[model samples]
Target: MKVRATAKRVAFGLCVFCLLVYLVFPFGWALVSSFKTNAELFATPARFWPAHPTLEHYRHVLANDDFLRAALNSVFVACSVTLVSLAIGALSAFALGRYRFRGRSLVLYVVLSMTLFPQIAVLGALFQLVNALGLYNRLPALTLTYLVFTLPFTVWVLTGFLEAVPIEIEEAAIMDGASPLQLFAKIMLPLAAPGMVTTGLLSFIAAWNELLFALSFMQTPDKRTVTYAILSFSATTSSAFEVPWGQMMAASVLVTTPLVVLALIFQRRIIAGLTAGAVKG
Candidate 1:
């Protein structure tokens, strides 16, 4: 029995190690390649490690005015989307989760159905709408378009968190002569902080990484997002072989690392927020 238990432990450890390697290898390779030179990146043997690591790719990508501007645009749009999504979603979720209302089920289903639609399906309609509104090629366009998807998700996730809050608390506030807005502002929002953080972070990442909406809505160079800037690095050359792999990898790392760090930092809150609504207290 002792021998069998030891073998099981060893096998479990090996399986976990393999899973970690599979999941982490791609990002690890990208990070390593970010440090490599053009010649080293596409060496004859396709080396895993750079012979001479350098920061040239980072410098070049940072020096590009287009990349810099796009980074700023992405930051603005992502932050806007997060703030707006949270504000509106919190209100919607609270109403849906807490109050009795007409068409509540229908409204929730409609919101859920919106998430079911593919981005491509709405592309044409969104294009015409944005053009009609004179929002084409603008950063605010992304802020609005992104809400189509992000808002639904934020509401859905946050509904659970809000629902998990003990109803007795809300009842107590009500009995204490708290107005509806005061009750929500002073009581409910604070309780849902974990869910809010998770949803906001997810919304920010979605807006930051959004490509299709950005491509369609933003035509002007100044309003383009980071994803477009990454594409620009590869689009500089005609031939596939001439594409700047080093810079592309470097830019990818730059774009991905920060979000990954945030997710890791708030991983506990993310887990808690996601599952908070599953069971009532």
Candidate 2:
């Protein structure tokens, strides 16, 4: 029995090791490929290390005026989406989680159902609406459109978190002369902070990486986001008649670096937040 158990443990370890390799190998390849020169990249069988590592790609990408503008547009859209989604999601979640409203389950089902609809299906209508409002190709329009995908998920997750908070605590706060606003702002908000961070992080990442809407809505080069900028690298041409793989990869690395750092820094809080809602309930 002991030998069997030992074998099982070894098997589990091997599975985990394999999973880690599967996830990390692509990133490792991208990182290495980003440094290789155009000649080195297309060489047969591709060497793991760049024989002549250079920062020319990074320099070229950063030197472009449009890159900075695209990055800024992405940041603005993502930040606005995250803040707005959180505020609206939190309010809706509290009503659903704390109060005994008629047709509450029906309302939640309808909200969740929105997530099932493909973005492409409504793109035409949304584009027309934004254009009618004179917000086409604008950052605010993109931010508002992003909420269509993000808001439902945020509400679902936050509702779970809010429901996990014991009602007795809220009652006690009320007994202590706490107004509804005070109870929510002081007590409930603090307890729900972790969940808020988790949901906001997700919303930010979604908006940051969104490509379809940005591509469809924004017409001008300057109004594009990072994803659009990256696409431009492939779309636009140089006199050389070759794609700049190294520079594209470098741009990708630059764009994703902050997200990687954020994930690493908030790893603990994110995990805690995800589990806290279920654990308390």
Best model number under TM-score: 2
Looking at model 2, which ten-residue stretch has the lowest summed lDDT?
Answer: 272-281
The lDDT values for all models are 0.91, 0.89
lDDT of 2 by residue, 136-240 (tens): 888889998999999998898888888899889999999999987788789878888988899899899999999999999998998999999998886675645
For residues 1-281, what per-residue lDDT tens digits would candidate 1 score against the true structure?
Answer: 99999999999999999999999999999999999988888688888888899999999989989998999999999999999999999999999888878998888889889999999999999889899999998888899999999999999888778878888899999999999999889999999999998999999999999999988887777888999889877776558668898888999999999999999999999888888978765
TM-score of candidate 2 relative to the true fold: 0.95
Any idea how many clashes model 2 has? 0
146 Cα displacement, candidate 2 (Å):
0.5
* lDDT for 281 (candidate 1): 50
